[model samples]
Target: MLQINDLTFDAWGRRFFDHASVSVPPGAKVGLVGRNGVGKSTLFKLILGELPAGDGEIGYPKQARLASVDQEHPATPVPLLDTVLAADVERDRLLAALETAEPEQMGEIYARLSEIGADRAPSRAAEILSGLGFRQDDLARPMAEFSGGWRMRVALAAALFAEPDILLLDEPTNYLDLEGALWLESRLKKYPHTAVVISHDREILNNSCDHILHLIDGKLTLYPGGYDAFERQREEKAKVQEATRAKVEAQRAHLQSFVDRFRAKASKATQAQSRLKMLARLPPVSAVAIEHTTPFVLPSPDRPLAPPLVRLEGVTTGYDGVPILKGMNLRLDLDDRIGLLGVNGAGKSTFAKLVAGALPAMTGHLARSARLKVGWFHQHQIEALDPDDTPLDIIRREMPEASEAARRSRLAQYGLGAAKVETRVENLSGGERARLLLNLVAAEAPHLLILDEPTNHLDIDSRRALLDALNDYQGAVILITHDRSLMELVADRLWLAADGTIKPFEGDMDDYARFVVERAKQAGKAPTQIRAAEPDPPPKPAPARAKVPTGPARRRAEAAEAALARASQALADIDRALTDPGVFAENPAKAADLGRRREAAQAALEAAELEWLEAVEAYEAMKG
Candidate 1:
């Protein structure tokens, strides 16, 4: 268990906590949540001992191991698989010992390997990577081969693969697609150790965490159950606090008025004095700090939208002239709300770029309405902001002829008000910058909006605000984001971007999620395969028959039946061995060996049963 008592810390000339305390029990999955700059990461740093606490004590089990995702990874020649596998320090230590141990110590090394389950480390690492959207070929690739987002995934995979006693994940789903996020949520559900996940994804927090730790106004409050429960509890608490504050203020107002009106009168002087004393005795009530909703209201388009705002015929383009989309034909109606779906590195962003006119098609006819004004947002655009310029400064330059008052009014709608408007771009948080970008785009009153991962850095409140804006938006939207909730709420049609083509998905987001996950599961050459990608290629047509003698088909069915019987018997024997206490108590080495053997036997039995079923089906088809 990890215990924090009255923990207090100071950073950037501000004291974060005065007497905040919270306890994380063993195997507890806690979701840490708060607005930006509320000290969630600072608290994590203090727990990790990277920052010294100014007051109070934090205690944890002496032997507890910790694992956390790093935001940056050094470029290296090490294979991605090896980098992730190295996260298991115990396995690495054992392997290191093997290289230096004496001949007599070989048995000890082997026994330790069995105990640690190091034999399956390679496959385990690969499984984790594939779940995070890495292909079969990516495992052996060098770390430098991947982009920054992929490297972040590697960091997450390494942290999760470590299986530490305490795992700290801050925004782990930020860089993940819906499929990868769902896969991760499933994995976290089965995690056996303590974990604290810091995320803005509602579904992830709701499904993965068992508890919620809310940091508000320098005080830590622990709530029971998941995010939904926490939100309910918080709302209840806020209502109760508000009611109490109202009563207190009413009484205080009555007393203060009496003192003000009659304090100088001789007849009522004594009564006023009594009222003052009574008011002083009453406890002070501070109203709860309500959450800030995005004040960023989007202004409606100045002109009516025309149909077929964008049209592409025989579109083709790729990075460095390697065509990704060839002979593609797509049209965007003024009211179109299209959501792009694809796995990582599948060119979703490339398609968005092509539509937004950020990238010229290698060979295609691109047409747009004369009144079409595109508001294109991309991840790279965040870096393009001038570091020295404030949000207001940039807007002023963008709308040169507009009055200063107009620009400030527009930015104020985005919550940049006065204080944030003058702040340098470098000083703004990612979420703040995202809001500014949205505000800038909204100011243009464009007929078509192309947003790529616009909500990647936004908080829940900001996301809600954006969702509301999109629902009310009159412009055509071409969106590419991993936010499933947003996609479901805003998208009118789903488009699949894969296999070097752009096409409409026949089903909803759930169907697309399943397809992407299946793709990942088929990633590499692994011993145990997930359900086959395409499913048994529509079986061969059977010959028409009324009745036939059991001949070669019967023989093959009989052989298959025999194989299944043998496999089942072997599994039963292993199960019986596992149930015996003496088998494990007498020999730890033997027990660990049996455990691995049982898994293999189970897989073999499954395969054997499948083979038998196929044989029976074939025989039945032949008879038909």
Candidate 2:
């Protein structure tokens, strides 16, 4: 469906693609994978004829329709559903023609209608919209009312509705929730037309693609299977190259040593000269330098503590009397793992800032324990570092009390060796700066870690390392990440921040995903479907009669039950703090009192929770 031969593209006087060739056959599902800024989007543009190829030819099959969903949406005031329907101009025209036909021309119109209908088939716009997670009611809602992520979904719907012979999707899963992403994957899997998608989501590529086109250093290499296959092949090739380089270097060293030893001796002079000449004729083996991979090292607190690290009571936060968060009462206990989830511009960052003490709440009181320490990693954390300082310098400044050997060891742990450690922070790439910032934070060993979009601009390897570190971290964590895979790996619970409130989901990642989808459907924001129920197991048999309880056993059981009740009451208090509107309002004094009360309640709740857990464990052990 699409073909490129000797294609070369240049931007800013730098060659991004040089004599690269690739092909997407009819009905093929191909994934374009590469490092950032490697011209994946440029290649798509060339195939779509949106950009001129510098030195090679790009061709599309004649009569083939093409569509693409780039990073940004085209500005339009029309509703999202209307925009998708407009893609099929022919369908609209045919409908219009059918509606206006007269009885007198029915005979003549019928023949023309048949021909036109056969050639220009009407599109199933409604079905396409539903399949892409748009509800029937949302069809008339203004596009401006939706967020950027939803707008991207609308654009995707339009592209799919067009029924193009070949579709080019670039970073389609960038801002999607798990449900939306899975919907797109299912659609692409069943799509009859050819497709080329560029995505950083390994799961998406593995599930939806059949072929892999890897772009590296202006060259395109094709792997027959999916992403997993491509990765395996790449690893094997790297191993082969390393072995070959090592063998060639060993032979060259051996020949050089023989020449040096025998060059001045007459008996072996002729042979030595022959060996020297042969060595000189041997082609040099150029091996790319392999750097040690950095492991993400999250800071470990010196001592783990009890609950009530931070408390928010009846707090409302926003700008200039406008509120984004209203009546939010929350408590952060030590060792709580929470994932903050919401669409873009949904106050996720604002909440993070409030917790970090970077911004004061408009009305609510923020309570933090005196001993609590916070380590915040912002979305644009690189900007927080001093550009003129070297990586080692930043580490030293951040951790002054540490020994020289310790500082160097920490730098090395973050993949900053002796050479790169000396390079100015300003000269580092985005990924490098991210690593350095993480290294600096890890040195602090704070008790509370707050990360905002930590996965942004990071490669797969870096992301994996960061996730691994989070898994091992013992401190309380609040992670604001767009990467679903990262969330699944690191988060033990989810905090859904939406519509001026925060809702907690005390379950696994899958349950949280289901909740989001169901909520969206309930709000008339997404398509709804009935799910099948699983079969239930048979009831258990009654237990045998128990022996009479002793006095100590009865007292212990009574105490445990009382503790459980107290913990339940504390939970209610925390909930009230979260739902208090005074904190979110414009009155600071009123908010402060409420905040204090909320903190006290949270402390009570934490103590209750601990006691309850202990009681439950005891109860379970006794029953066992």
> Each model's TM-score, in the order given?
0.79, 0.64
Candidate 2 lDDT by residue in tens digits, 1-624 = 677899888887799998998877789888998776678888887887788779988888788898898754565678655677677666556556776778776666567657645333223454455445555566676778777667777788788877788999987765554446655666677788999998776666777888888888898987878788998988888888888888888989999999999999999999999998889887776685443447887767988666789888988887777888888889987757788875545678888888888877888777888887888887467777678888778777777998988888878888777888889988877778887776566656888898877766676667777887876676878988656777766665577676776766444445544444443334333222222121121122223322221222333555666776776776676667657676567677866776677678667667766766676676556544
Off by over 4 Å in 1: 250-281, 522-624
Backbone atom clashes (below 3 Å) for every candidate: 1, 8
The residue ranges of model 2 lying beyond 4 angstroms of the native Cα positions read: 96-138, 144-153, 177-179, 244-298, 311-331, 342-354, 357-367, 377-444, 497-503, 511-624
Model 1, total clashes = 1
Q: After superposition, how far is residue 107 of candidate 1 from its true place, in Å?
A: 2.9
Pairs of residues clashing in candidate 2: 315-584, 316-583, 316-584, 328-578, 329-577, 329-578, 363-583, 364-583
In angstroms, give how far residue 70 of model 1 lies from its true place: 2.5
